[model samples]
Target: MAVVFVITLAMLTAATVISGSPVTLTLERAFPTNHGVELNQLRARDLLRHRRILQSSNGVVDFDVHGTFDPFQVGLYFTKVQLGTPPVEFYVQIDTGSDVLWVSCSSCTGCPQTSGLQIELNFFDSGRSSTSSLISCSDRRCNSGIQSSDATCSSQNNQCSYTFQYGDGSGTSGYYVSDTMHLDTIFEGSVATNSSAPVVFGCSNQQSGDLTKSDRAVDGIFGFGQQEMSVISQLSSQGIAPRVFSHCLRGDSTGGGVLVLGEIVEPNIVYTPLVPSQPHYNLNLQSISVNGQALQIDASVFATSNNNRGTIVDSGTTLAYLAEEAYDPFVNAITATIPQSVRTVVSRGNQCFLITSRLG
Candidate 1:
């Protein structure tokens, strides 16, 4: 499935555009301003290293998530999202790691004022939208969607408040609110079908840690996780879109790529079975090989025991990680194949060699 950051989805209606067919959304690289290839590599490397520091933790938000950034890798790829009536556009990160979409709300504290990505940062004001409504504590979505132990409905109107703490000690706290979102669905690389879908999202009033850091900040994040609170699930449940989506990432020179929802017709595309009864899209890893040579390691090192432990294919993760037991063997095999003449260098925890001559 192509993980999608859905802005809006509508039941295919004759008034707007075709229904039951696939629709595409355009995506632009979040790091258009950072031109250095080495800097980008270092940023990606840092993110990979951060993986070692991560551990399973529970926090708020429909999906308890922590967001991290290196100024160079802050915006890997994001899309334009229009929220509220008299719509204001915000460039939001399309994250598949978590569920529940959120944007910094008006009167936000510690949110960035300026972003190096060349887009003006803006806050979402529910008061400004005539179509906006609050999700209260008594609401079914409130009771079931956000499973945080600290969730409380103590407001005068019983408004549901949320606290989202990330693994890296960054977090946001806010209340639940619903508003209209505008989306443009592209067809055949030219024509766009405009549609609006109503969605409930978090309007964060506070942000801390990396979220407060201005160097890599954006308007917010749009999560495409495997939960009822996710944008895809909301659209699918409302009959506005199918349960499947797909996206293609293009090179820097190509400007950007395409993200599509519903049915994608491509004969060149192949399919894989999703590991059953799992939250994220997971698949079993049977073996590891580099350059057609399978590494010498026990296959059981990649095995899963508990239902939740396994390898997952996530769109938000830019780096691949392996168990330390598996990592050593894999690294040794790769280094042995490199020519002795090329000197190796480590930058931001990434090992590399600047070789002008080809060696197999």
Candidate 2:
């Protein structure tokens, strides 16, 4: 289901201490003021597509998501990323749903040149960067980071090509490249220092579906999913940044938010351990509740096993979804508390109560 929830997580590593100072990135709304409801439709469509993939496949890798946030929608958040030796800036959607930082490259077929968010869209050219280098399929980094163990590599010079398909039949195909990525880390109260680090990212040579459109397109996506190919994993592996990161998203769409790398020195913050070895941030869900009323269901429904895909907390999705067996009982119990006179109306494909007046 397309859920619009924002959750922050802290990923800790026992092997090494965090090297760099904390960095802060500003998140800009993908859509400007007066964006319409069509944003929800687009999100729902994408979420529906993603659900099918989840049901069909388990632990999908080598996937690079296209422009994550809708350029014409108000809910999606994005930022500008400066990369390469000459320091070219590219607008990328900051997503917590997936891993791998990728952008459209020069001469990419069907890639949009402009965005509706009033930003100058530019394609990444490895030739322009003096420090840019191709990552071959034979490289250990490619094998460990983006490729599966069963994947084969021919030679050291063989370019590591990747094809990322989205749920909506949209995808981007490209090769891997590494270059310098710049970021500003916050040192102390409003004082920040600039730093640069070498990282691997995708250079898309072709794109299809929604990525080819300008209305919801940007440079590419900066995924924060739990994967080895993610920027967090690469930086942590190189001792440039910590394995931990946190974000505080504003509820208001127009107001921007903060994405911080490393520990957040804030008061009254509580953290829990993350489940190891899962595609997303897999968490053990205890129970479900509505208005302080916990649902009366079998504990096995919330159980996690080797085959059962448990609960995940993602900031990129637009709606919350429940399993079929869990959904029926939850909905019935919720409607049980409501008056029979209250009619039901369908809104955006979801059931809504049509009460004549507010009755809380």
Could you estimate the TM-score for every candidate?
Answer: 0.73, 0.71
Give the alpha carbon lDDT tens digit for every residue of 63-152 in model 2.
122232333364466767888988998888777767878999997998998887677999999899999998887677788764532123
lDDT of 1 at 21: 61
Q: Best by lDDT, which number?
A: 2
Best candidate per TM-score, number? 1
| Candidate 1 collision pairs | 2-245, 2-246, 66-166
Which residue pairs clash in candidate 2? 2-318, 2-319, 3-317, 3-318, 3-319, 4-318, 4-319, 98-225
* Segments in model 2 whose C-alpha atoms lie over 4 Å from true places: 1-72, 146-157, 167-169, 190-193, 336-344, 347-349, 353-359
Q: Positional deviation of 166 in candidate 1, in angstroms?
A: 3.5
RMSD (Cα, Å) for all candidates, in order, is: 14.3, 14.8
lDDT of each: 0.67, 0.69
Residue 200 lDDT (model 1): 78
